[model samples]
Target: MDIPVRAHIERLLDAHASDGLSEAVEQAFRAVPRHLFIPPVALACRDDGPQIIDRDADPDAWWDAVYSRASIVTQLDDGATDIRAGSGDYTCSSSAPSTVADLLQRLELAPGHRVLEIGTGTGWTAALLSHLVGAANVTSVEVDPVLGAQAASNLAASGHAPYLVVGDGALGCPERAPYDRVHVTCGIRRVPYAWIEQSRPGAVIVLPYCPGFGTDHALRLVVTPDGMAYGRFPGFASYMTMRAQRPQRDQPARTDADKHHLTTRVDPRTIGHAPAGADLAIAALTGLDSLGQADQDEDGPRYRLWVSDPAVPRSWAVAVWRPGQDEYQIYQVGDRPVWEEVVAAYFRWVGWGEPGRDRFGMTVHADGQEVWLDTPDQVIGSEARSAC
Candidate 1:
């Protein structure tokens, strides 16, 4: 084992003992050089974690990005649009060690399992799988040409050549069907028909179900001969949604300047178990009281959340747009009191037992897109609609 890398793996194993994920960590360490898998010369080792070896920030000081315990983001916004500076909504990353460990533990890949990894961000995960199941049985798909080329080079240099393809992962590479294990590195709003059709019966597929949960969570599913599997979210995770599969959250504001409304901040304390804290708020409002969808407005890079609750006479905003921008406006008529109603969710959670974020359960139906929260009974679904 690589001495320096092994030390880091040992620490990680010690940190997260539940998963017993050291084997996978060691595999990542020994099989691939920490340097090559990231942007050339943009990585730095840090005591707490991996430091950003951002290439665009300083071209002259480009350093290898592969650092101990660091997950380098190879593609952001699925590499569709450039943010110029500051990483925005990390879309594709060489997933961090802790996250990788969690997924591996949940996935539990055995030897000789043919694995197809969708949304190969940096090819490191595939390389680790190569160490376990051998390169011939591993197939990885990457959407970005730039990242894919870099990943190909990294894999080639690492001496593990899996079938790496640069194309839309939404359509799982059908050329190699009947994979025993299908791992999706990217977050997806929709579980594509192509993936189910291609996998073998009883195949274990792991992917981040995106957009549904306020945050993405890993969905560990089983494949039947007919391409159907029932699985709940393994845990909360954040991954870049697949480029082709990114959900269209184009919720246009309610352009009723003449209209008025009532709104409130879903108490942060009540961020109990539900796909995401935000989703939990939405679920409670829709179920308990009469409410429709929520709306957030972006003004020159800042987002202002706008909500309307017919139950209340007044409205307010608790700020869900962007965390940093200084634009938190909380308002409610003394009588309407939206904040009080919002806090009512917290009390409800307390009454039920304060379940943390993980306890929240989700069941993806046969369609794969529709999700029910807090068991199938708490049905909270998302659809493409104008921001309202």
Candidate 2:
């Protein structure tokens, strides 16, 4: 409509032209006005800090932000706190234009194709999908009823009415069975078997797989003849975790005298900020998730690599790195040998030729999923905890 946010978005879509962003997909992007989907009062996430924009207070700023590359924060604390009040886990939002463009391109939608969408946040993506394929062919599911109703109104005002269901998206909309394509907006820890069961063979499912480890990835999976779906990581993605699969809050650290103490030459940053492939490898092998936190000490900068099991919250390990130190201290507080297993996994990833995210593949079936290297049979790990 309004001239499109042509430069940056076009360049991003064009770069992925070979594998994604077909002409129809680009037109669909131009067709959906992002501002219509965004709330009047929302937060625009920035690297420095989140700036709150209110349409009534400053319509100019709100319009600019909706068109900008920043993702708009629509809800905070799952709607527990007012967005203007500030400070809460980002529960929901309209994804950045770049992310929406990348994922829609990967969907490869065709006119008249049946599509099932999960997490109908703001309904912008469903509208886009409806534009690509007829609106009657699209079905969207949202977990939150309030957001679902709001999204319904937004879609109606925009002259698109895709089927909207209020239910847990992980379960999927089974009534609209045998979908031609599946598009997911939320980050998933487990690939729900229901999704595969509902889709026909050869369905293309695109989702953000956030394992709570290092960097999350965008996966493009194709359902197979035998009812299994296999795919590879196309690139990195960082979306909020699916509400159903969100991890428990970490318990306070134990200060027991029997704690294991060790020192290693490996910098904590090496493991903390490892490439996406290594993150997948280590999480799969050790059954542990990791995150790095930065701190300032008297000597300048320090890093802490936190490794913990999502299933067993009590078991954890922390590797601390200080400036100018060849040796870093590692503290293990549980029986999992969390540090040792992580070190082994780290070296194992290195031994496998230091594969990047592109070389990793995932297989999802009814029971669970597995992450493999290069091919399906060469499964590096069989845990479904990080597969979705």
Candidate 3:
């Protein structure tokens, strides 16, 4: 049953080989049985998004989902929610085949090289790494104990055995230090210095950088001899945040109701429509999390932007814009001028030629991480320089 589906996936991946997919990764996909790693009733990958696939309820749909180029959500709300009940928050998933292939290709793995993988959600990636670098050279760490044990079982069933550690993935597995490559399967707001410290100089570290404003991007950093990791974001990616670094979803406290109102000629949509790099720039500059929503008003369409510090609840800002309006209304509270900083970031991004994620890179030093555009000398904002 798995043979034909595996072949079809391999063919699809091979078609994309010219676009960065490598033959080695294609072979790894062909050899591994992804279904073995997922739950009996799990959400299968689909073009539109994830759809539930219950082997007992619908076998054919389940098979198709296992073979589809989509990510299978294995756990919801960190395993607290009942997926069988219909809806839940996505916590862990078997990443889409194409995404996994892309990350592996970017890794540029070689035989006999030691690799450390963080966030072994379902163990499919670990199996692929084992196939590429031999099981003895692969070490995978998972933050969830249940997921770790399940991954171990799945790997054993697939006849591949890799070192599996059940602990926080943010702190890379030091038991196996000096790894040649480190691949993280989760999104992180801040890249842990421990990952750089654990890797050998020149080792490559790939992870999804999600600063919580726009979409996440796959950041590829190479460990430097001077105990720093620096690299550029190649493309956009979406992954679950590490357990420890997950954003607090709580709404900001409504303590300060004395909101200062002001008017700005800058349209909110301009910043909203800006490239993902602009969001990264805003996050770096303001050091604040932003959320945007759209709705219909009596006048027509309306958009609202919320910028606040999740850690420090005192400072928050809101900007409201309506279509055909030249001056947008802004309400700011606390010491920080959140909306003003966002405007500054937008102009700064445009001043630097409005570069894409590829043109932007990050340097993670002992002092702090600094986001740079085109070159490391040009830091994103004055705040980053002072923080570093």
Candidate 4:
């Protein structure tokens, strides 16, 4: 192994001790070289946004970024825009070293275990999986053809050739069925029934479950003999939504006359800045998604909270709060009472002793998914609805 690459792996291990990077996973990272998967010109990950790193312009800087703990953005706007431009919706990336290790640790992969990888973005993850399990036991699927071709090339260059399929990853590769483990890279709102049906009885599936609420969660599920998968959120994660599961929400443009103004004693920030457990309960109870935006103008700092039902195009509500105000004003204009629904969910969560995210779990079945608390039988909502 190269000294510089070894140094990077050591640094990642030291920094991410709390991430629970197992010794086997650390060895996999040591075996697979990170630089081989990244492009010459791409965006380096940042807290605010990604920045460009061009190998031709600055080899030292590019090399530094390639080995850093940060993720490198490989494609933007689904590769329609050049990566050098450095400004577009992030569509593809070589995931950060810490994120890779964290998810792989949750996977609990063993030697010779059959694995199915969803969203083979840069193929780095697939290559690592091939190293952990034999290349013959690994099957990776990518939704984009161009990315799929490039991933195939990257895997070959790295001296590992796993089964790569260019198709919708939402529909897991059924040709190679009964996998022992399923690893998903993209964030998904709905747990596809195809995955539950394709895996073995005791197979484990790990993915980032973005419920379109306050925060997203990293989910780990175990398949049962009855064709259902049950799991709990391990922690928080943010990732690009699966192409087929992207939310197409509509916030209707409205005039003052169209809006119905109401006032509430509950602070808008309470619901806007709620914890992950409350977020999950609210989404399951109401079947709605929400976002909070904070800004400062001449009138000082203000918070704007928007809630909507993605299924109902014209259904939405906004709650506005300004400093030094005892009560906030809510302007709602839609068929569904989104604000009311949120308030009800918030109180329900508070009544449940304010449970944390770990206390909540999800069960995915053929018709729909259900969110439960503590035990699988204690379901939160009466109706099963997929989180939007």
In order, the Cα lDDT scores of the candidates are 0.59, 0.86, 0.83, 0.88
- Candidate 4: C-alpha RMSD after superposition: 2.4
**Cα RMSD to native, each candidate?**
7.7, 3.0, 2.9, 2.4
**lDDT, candidate 1, 78-171, per-residue tens:** 5664534335556656677667767765667777888888876777788888887778999998878888887888888878899988888877
Q: Provide TM-scores for the models.
A: 0.69, 0.92, 0.90, 0.93
Which of the predicted structures, 1 or 3, would earn the higher lDDT when compared with the native? 3
Give me the runs in candidate 2 sitting further than 4 Å from their true place. 1-21, 250-258, 384-388
Candidate 3: list runs displaced more than 4 Å: 11-18, 45-50, 250-252, 256-258, 295-300, 331-333, 381-388
Candidate 1 — what's its lDDT?
0.59
Question: Per-residue alpha-carbon lDDT of model 2 for 1-388, expressed as tens digits?
Answer: 3444455345444544664456787787667777789998999986678999999999878877777778999999999999998789999999987788788878888899999999999999999999999999999999999999999999999899999999999989888898999999999888898899899999999999987778889999999989999999989777888899899887756667537888988888988888889998987787688889998977788899988888888788899998778899998776778888888899999999999999999999876889999989998877543344
Order candidates by lDDT, high to low. 4, 2, 3, 1
**Model 2, residue 259: C-alpha shift (Å):** 3.6
**Residue pairs whose backbone atoms clash in candidate 3:** none
In terms of lDDT, the poorest run of 10 residues in model 3 is 379-388
